[model samples]
Target chain A: MSRATELVLADYIVVALYFVLVLAIGTWFGKFTKSTADFFFAGRRFHWWVLAMSCVATLVGSYSFVQYSEVGFKYGFCAMTPYTNEWFVLPLFLFGWFPLMYYHRITSVPEYFHGRFNWQVRFVVTLILLVYLQGYVAVNLLTIGRIMKGVFGMPEVYGAALMALISGIYLHAGGQTSVLATDVFQGLLLLAAGIGVFLLGIAEVGGLAEFWAALPYHHRFPFARFNTPPYLHAVGNFWNDAMTATFAFYFINQGVLMRFLSARSVREGRKAMLFVVVVLMPVAAVAVSGAGWAGRAMVERGILPEDVDAGNIFVAVTGKVCGPGFQGLVLAAVVAALMSTLDTLITAVAAIGVNDVYRPVLPGRSDQHYLTVARIVAIVSAVLGISLIPVFQHYDTIYQALSDFLSTVAPPLAVPLALAMLWPRFHARAAIIAMVLGMILMITALNYPALVTPFAHGVDPSEGYSHMRSLFGLVTSLVIAVAATYLVPAAESAADRLTWFHIPRPRPARRRARHDIWHRRFRVQVVPGTDPRLHLHPETMKELDLQQGDVVYVCDARWWLGGLRSVHAVVGEPDDTLPRDTVRLSEEAVRRGYLKPRHRVILEYEEEPIDV
Target chain B: MGPWLPYVYVYGVGGCVFLASLVAGVRAGAIDLNRPADRRTLLALVAGLLLFATVHAIWIWAASQEPPVSDQAAVALTAETRA
Candidate 1:
């Protein structure tokens, strides 16, 4: 008798154990929350490192594993486009935009909209976010089911419900705490499994050089053919992928923007982002590309039948190469990844319901009631997600589904959010109309892509770039938003340029005879988001007794607080009071750049307080 | 699939347990579950390690069963029929 193989049974048991562990964790967190904030955003106490891992867990899902693996199996090394796109999103997140979030104090994208435009703008942005998020939620549910079917041989419907039930119960049980903390665990597991599978795959194929040699020429090199049609198609596809992903909403993503606000210091947030960029993002390359290589190995090994669907690529590879115990572990990792992303969407959707929907619909509810309602909303969303999975059963790829849904509102929102932040004239009416028009044009182009052939011109749509949606949406949103802002600028009388935080309590504002002078001194200096210990002068900050990154406006124009905006934070001089003892240095001294000593230069602004 | 991975996830699992205790309160109305959550955290981690190792073992066996990648003629023949 063949020895009873414990492999498959062990794998199932392991998957079951992983789920049970997740459930237990959720149950444990369910015991106590200090307050609603603890439930919602971990009391905003997560370190940057924690936040970074959570980000990875959120972005690197089972769908992505499958998406990349399929690409690898089909195209060999040419399957690097998505990996290339992942790299492109990093700099914008790391260097270009997120630092502003640490400086500009706001909660929720809507709050920024209110500051720049009005309540109308906030509503529009919220609606757009919901629309974009819904698609992601639906697709994730679909992925959960497909993963079950492929890896465990569960039926599609049962798999979908299983995911919905498991994710919904735990998500409702712990809220953001479960999502965040579990993400860290999930991210680590997924990363390690991915790297192991890839290394083994490369070895199986006799290393990278040997693998490349075995592949056909075009399969090994994707972009070698540079004809006009193909080249433009490639260029546009790359831009669409990067630009849409990188566009800052208000200033940054709410999930991550909150990390800075919760940061103990600006230094912590900076370090946290740096850690992610340096450590985690590189690891992500292994997951995406390694899965691809594993896919190729599976195909070449004849483990995958010729008739298998492209979507089944990862499932086949993982099943054929990894034994019972490892297969269960790998399957669990896939589920973890899928759940990691899916839970983020569910939490965000619940927040919308809690803050934006339930509270408004029934206002007098207690905080306890609000919390209960939030949990219910998550469960409801999961149910809806389950219902929607069947519709996408007809679609080809999960990642492609993600793109189609996201591409809808990205262009309109990207333009308005950026413009509203930098340009004061970006008014609400203009924003609303532009967003609506951009969406309409996008849908039209997606349906009748031929209408966009002048732009896509001889490019094939079936290759699935969906260029018409991205390009047309971009053109329409920019044109409409910019024109509306310029042509119909909001009434000067209607717009207010003050913030609640800046509107000081008058009693404190008038306390000292030197108040006017102090206000004038602090006029041009921005309240930096970074901690003085990290970004400001050593001598001056030690004595101030003020919190780092807090807005401390004195009367005189002092360069010590950094640039025109709080984001450009660095120390400029030693003291606002001591002109003689002052260390006069270059402008970079006040912001994050090199400072060379130069003759002192000063900026001018109003000394008298504007009517508050 | 080794011992190290479960170690990496320890912090995350512990944190999740601590967080989930609050969810139990919000849902069923009483949340003195932190004690049990802590216990579960350890159990979950141990279980996870075992699971990963098992999957790896299965993968090795499966790899042995599949035909070698060097069978070029068979691959070409399959490709022809699929097309």
Candidate 2:
């Protein structure tokens, strides 16, 4: 069989159109990004649905399609184990870490360490996190390059470089805003194409019943065998994929954290998290793995050759089932998956570089200077990511490479992070020791697989012991952190706002009859003041039920921007000189909110809660 | 391994993590289980877990019962049609 599959002209046209559309959407959002905050977190303005959808795009990495489909063909529905098992972490995330990060406005994981512990902890974490994020970028680029080679007969390096260049262009243009916007579009396309492949495959096989009959009995099981298969056992995958990797993705992945931070409110962020795990993930599991399942069924029925390469199962199946233009569309979805994830990781690296590395070393720089630095870092990050693609090419399978990489790096950082968030008694000294020791131990396990044998849970360590390394790392790190915390003297106390304890609860709204009149929109003017205050006409204040010293949320009338053009301010003494139809915001508030000088704005009572 | 083993492993190990996080949240005063909203949320999470487990178990059982076409039979059928 030929290494490369043939593609018709229609396929090229569809892929080209997809590239143009994504670029257009990304660059269009560029105009809205003015400051570092806007560039990194999209001005904290996205609605929950947008964040949720964009997050789904990021979560379904390009490697997800190639790797999961490869496994789906070989194993069966067990390919979905990673996606299905994320629900267990939802409670910890929503109740513990989500609010901690959101309310405290922690921009990066390293920044959180700095705030909760000390500079030493932050510096240690910053290095590990940079390696992890850049590695993630490399994994994505490599997968897309593999796809290009399988379908278009292109060299892997050139394909990887092309993808990196495309992702970097839009990320440089608009940053997080562009990433969010383009991801939403790509997320939908990804789901549609994935499901479309399965549907088309079903038709080719005669019907759903025929498809089911075509799969072998052993392949129909939902989980892999318990422990016999050293490489892909249920027990080993539980520790590596479900527990360690998933925890790292939500807790420490800077890209995923930025999605939550970009929410308009904490409540919206919670909604997005619930929707992602409960609704989107299961669908995404099917979407990403459907091609492989179909391919397996087709092979069983002799619709395709039985000797089809497992690694190229996705491309083989798409070529067999999808006709001309439709084939291109499916390929575009693969590109969408790669680009969506790559852009997020690239932007995240930029945020970490600027916030954690650059700003601390050179404090008191202008926002513009930092913004320029962020853009430059984004370009450099993409370049570095492309360079690492060659390193990952040595691994036998994409699944093994990604799983081994995440399992090794995630547990050490994940254990320390969980301890820091949940256990206030966890000291800075303990964090530093645990993180350092954890790395040493994990690296030792890489060199000496025997170290992981004890934690392998009866699985043979001879073949694929890497998956069990996470369990070993976690146990060792937890023990070291606990022992060190008690043995060492504690330093200064962590502020209540930073820990899970003493998270500020929202106060109940005032007891009063609500009226539609309070929803009135008013024209905003920049008052000559430096304080963060909003001035309202007496009648307007009375109508909105606002009082002096009350915290009010003032936002641009164009609600479609979400909360991008919004700010919270203390309501000043009513300005009798102002017109009833207008409200005046301090110059500082206007600038902070990115509010237009003469634009109409709305005001609502913001029951000021005690800061966490 | 039994068909029920995967579910057992998932909930058994995953259940510990869930409970530990819940206990930590309650201890931190971040999650007030006494509140109606909090209680409802906890219940919903438990229900969702059980629901997924039930659906997966049913799928496995149903799929297991379907008689698969033998490889030789499938290949023979294809060859016959081609001839």
DockQ of each: 0.01, 0.42
Each candidate structure's TM-score, on Cα atoms with residue i matched to residue i, is: 0.65, 0.88
TM-score of each model's B chain? 0.37, 0.64
Encode model 1's per-residue lDDT on B1-83: one tens digit a residue: 22223222322343343334334322332222233422342244334434533543453343334344466568988999999
Worst 10 residues of 2 chain A by lDDT: A509-518
lDDT tens digits, residue span A1-612, model 1: 001213467888988998888677665655434345545655443446767776777767556777667766665543544333333233323222343333344446665666666767777777766655666678788777776776566777788788778778877877776776677778887888778778766666677766655554334433212213342333454446435654542133455454444442333454565555445755775676576666665456554466666666666556556676886777777788888888877877777667665665688877788888878888988888877777778766755656665777778777776555434456787878887888787777777776666655345666433653566677778899888877875644324232211221211222222222233222122233543322234443443332233333221133431211222222333454533323332243234222222323221111122111
lDDT (Cα, tens digit) per residue for candidate 2, span A1-612 = 123546789988998999899989998888768789889989776668889888989999867787899999999988988888887788888888887887777889999999998888899889878877888788878878887787677988888898888788888888998999999999999999999998888788889989888787767878887775787888878888788888999999999999888876666687788788778999999999998999999998898898999988988888788888887888888889889989999999999999999999999999999999999999999898888877778765754655566666688788889888888788898888888888788888888989888888888877848678888998999999999999988777754457788576764454331243246778887867687878888887776767787766677877676665777778888989999988887787787777897778777665424221
DockQ of 1: 0.01
Off by over 4 Å in 2: A1-3, A145-158, A387-405, A491-497, A510-546, A549-570, A574-612, B33-44, B64-83
Please state the error at residue A443 of candidate 2 in Å. 2.5
lDDT to native, each model: 0.55, 0.82
TM-score of structure candidate 1: 0.65
